[model samples]
Structures are given as structure tokens and as C-alpha cells.
Target: MSYQENYIKQLHTLLRLVTDSVEGYKSAAEHVDSTEYKDLFNNISRQRESIAAEFRERISGYGGNAEVESPDLMASLHRSWMGIKTAMTKKDDQAVMESCRNGDQALLDAFDDILQGDLLNNADLKTFIMDQRLKVNEVFLDLDDRYFKLFKKDPSI
Candidate 1:
């Protein structure tokens, strides 16, 4: 593929991942019973939506189609699994939090994959990706801390 094609492809991949994250967060918010958790997930979903918009703009600027025709297969399956798990656990808050944590980790992994690749050589794009990754990592860590606190408070969780 040409340089432009490769660059656009990378942006598309990021866009799809962020889009999946948005849906995943929204789903988590809906499934969880905690008002605080719901608010947190909804806020994160909005943040992810903004990031996805940036990716779309970058793809468009590169003369590539920015529209994601469908959700990634793996992400769709993950969401389905989350729903089933939530149901099985009877909408347990801990289970919902655990699923969200896993989804966030998947997102962070995608960011790491793209950042480690040489194809992302553009300085501006690289910086943008780094900034977004940091934001995601910050939230992931917060979620991790919260999960552990909850787990510690009640081992049964």
C-alpha cells in the first residue's frame, strides 16, 4: 500500500477501536446499578466519542473515507460477552466493572500496537496518538484502582 493508504488505514483502525469503546462504555453504564459508575462510564463514553471524531477528521484530511461501515467483529463479540456476563451475574456491579476494565485494557493494547509501529511516522499524528493514549491510560488506571478498592472492601465481589 502507498504511504497515504497505510496512514489512513491506521487512523481507521484507531477510529474503529474508539468507536467500540464508546459503545462499550455506554453499555457498561446501562448495565451497572451504581449511579456513580453509570455517570463515570457515560462521561468516558463522551470522551471516546470526541476522540473518534478526531480520527474521522484525520482520515478525511488524508483523502480517505472516514466512515466505519460496521463494528469490529472482536469488539462486537466482546460486547455480547459482557452483556451475557452481566445477566449471568444478575447485573452485579463488580462484574460490570471487571468487564469494563478488560475492554479498556483492549483499547490500551490497540494504542500500544499502533504507537510501536513505524508506519506512524508523522510527528503530529504520533503526538496526537500519544496524548490520546495517555488520556486512556489515566482512565484505565483509575478504573483499576476502583476495582481493587471494591474487591478489597468485599472479597465476595
Candidate 2:
């Protein structure tokens, strides 16, 4: 596969993971029964939607399907996150928050790598980077803050 193809595949994988995590957050919020938790869930959902849309636009630039879902991959990601969330919950609220932060950080780093690579030397990436890349970085910073605050309350909680 070409670099474009490989990069698209990785970005697609990451965006789908975002979608799954957002759904999990939404579900957890439903079960949370806490206003604060619900607010965070809703914010994550909105952010996920925006990030997914940006990724879709980027993928379409390569004349590929903007959104494709595979049963096996999707199911696997969902199941994996389910276990992750459960284990984080078993630890503490701070742990759960840190997990969310870590996930966002990973995605942000992936995109940054793509932007720095020669693949981004093209006009398409140049145009999009001037706009979308900054926005994505901002979102990453916000997500970090959202989770970091919880950890600040009690480092060991």
C-alpha cells in the first residue's frame, strides 16, 4: 500500500476508535447519574463528531470512502474499550479521567505525525492543515484539561 493508503487506514482506524469511545462515554453517562459526568459525556460526543467529520473530509480527498465500517474491527474496538473502561472504573474516577486523556493524546499525536510527514507536502494537506490541524490540536488540549482537572483533585483518588 502507498503511504497515502497506509495513512488513511491508520486515520480511519483512529477515527473509528473515537466514535466507539464517544459511544461508550455516552452510555456511561446514562448510567452515571451525575450531572458533571453527563456534561463531560455530551462534550466528548460533540468533539468526536467534529473530529470524525474532519477525518472523513481528509479521507475523501484520496477518492476513498469517507466512512467505512467493518463488523470485526468495530466489534473488537468496542469490546476492548469496554474492558478498558471497566478496569479504569475499578481503579478510581481519576483513573478513568486519565484514560480518557491518554486516548485523546494518542490520537492527537497520530495526527501530528501525519502533518509532519512528507505526505502533508501536498496542496490538499497544506490547505487542510492551515485550518483543521490547529482545531484538532486545540481539541486535544481541551480534552487534556478536562481530565487533568479530575486528577488534580486527588492524585491518588
Candidate 3:
């Protein structure tokens, strides 16, 4: 693929990931019994929605179509998360937090893949990606801390 085509595809992938994140967070919010956890997930879901919308607008500016649905990769990830939730006692906040930690790590991995790729050669795109990456990193760390506080162990291990 041409550089432009590749760039647009990556953007679409990121957009779809953000959309999937919103849906995942919403479902996670519903699964948790704690009010604080519910609110946390709900707020993150809204933030992901905003991020997805921004991605769509940016892709449109590049004369490309934004993805209307999550990509197969993210779709499978979502299904896997749902499966994990369904197989367990869903009322557990610790389980929900564990799911969140997994999701956060996945998201950071996605961001890292893009940031380390050629897509960042475009300065504007680079700035945007870096900014988003920082935000994702911050949230991931916060989620890790919360998990640690609840479980008394690092989730990354």
C-alpha cells in the first residue's frame, strides 16, 4: 500500500479500537456492582466515544472513510472479554478490574504499535498520536494502581 493508504488504514484501525473500547467499557460498567467502578467505566466509555469521533473527523479530513464498525481484531478481543465475564461470577468488582487491566494493556499495546510505525512521520499525525498515547498511558497506570490497591498485587505480573 501507498504511504497515504497505509496511514489512513492505521487511523481507521485506531478509530475502530476506540469505538470497541467504548463498548467494552460500557459493558464492563454494567458488569460491576460497585458504584465507583461503574462511574469510572462509564466516564472512560464516554471519553473513548469522544476519541473515536475525533478520529473519524480526522480521517474524513484526509478524504478517507471512517470505519463504521470495530475491526475483526478488536471484535474478537471484545468477544473474548465477554466470554471471560460470562464464565465467571460477574458480580465481582475484582473480576471487573482484572478485565479492565487486560483491556488497558491491550490498548497500550495497540498505541505502541502505531507510535513505533511509519504513521508518525507526519508531524500533525505524530503529535495527535503522541497526545493520545500519553492519555492512554496515564489511564492504564491509574487502572494498574487501582487494581493493586484492591488486590494488593501488581496486575502487570
All candidates: TM-score: 0.95, 0.67, 0.88
Worst 10 residues of 2 by lDDT: 70-79
34 Cα displacement, candidate 1 (Å): 0.6
Each prediction's RMSD over C-alphas, in Å, is: 1.1, 3.9, 3.0
Candidate 1, superposed: residue stretches over 4 Å from native: none
**lDDT values of the candidates?**
0.89, 0.62, 0.79
How would you encode candidate 2's per-residue C-alpha lDDT over 12-52 as one tens digit per residue? 76567656656655654554445776687678767767767
Backbone clashes in candidate 2 total 0
- Looking at model 3, report the run of 10 residues with the lowest lDDT sum: 70-79
Maximum-TM-score candidate = 1
What count of clashes does model 1 give?
Answer: 0
| Steric overlap count per candidate | 0, 0, 0
**CA shift at 52, candidate 2, in angstroms?**
1.3
Better of 2 and 3 by lDDT: 3
Q: How far does residue 6 in candidate 1 sit from its true spot (Å)?
A: 0.6
Candidate 3 residue-wise lDDT at 142: 84
TM-score, predicted candidate 1 vs. hidden true structure: 0.95
Predicted candidate 3 versus true structure: per-residue lDDT over 46-150, tens digit per residue: 888888888888888888997665454865676476657745874678777778778768877887898789976798987887787777788788888888798
Model 1, span 7-42: residue lDDT tens: 888888888888998999999999999999999999
Of the two candidates 1 and 3, the one with more favorable TM-score, higher being better, is 1
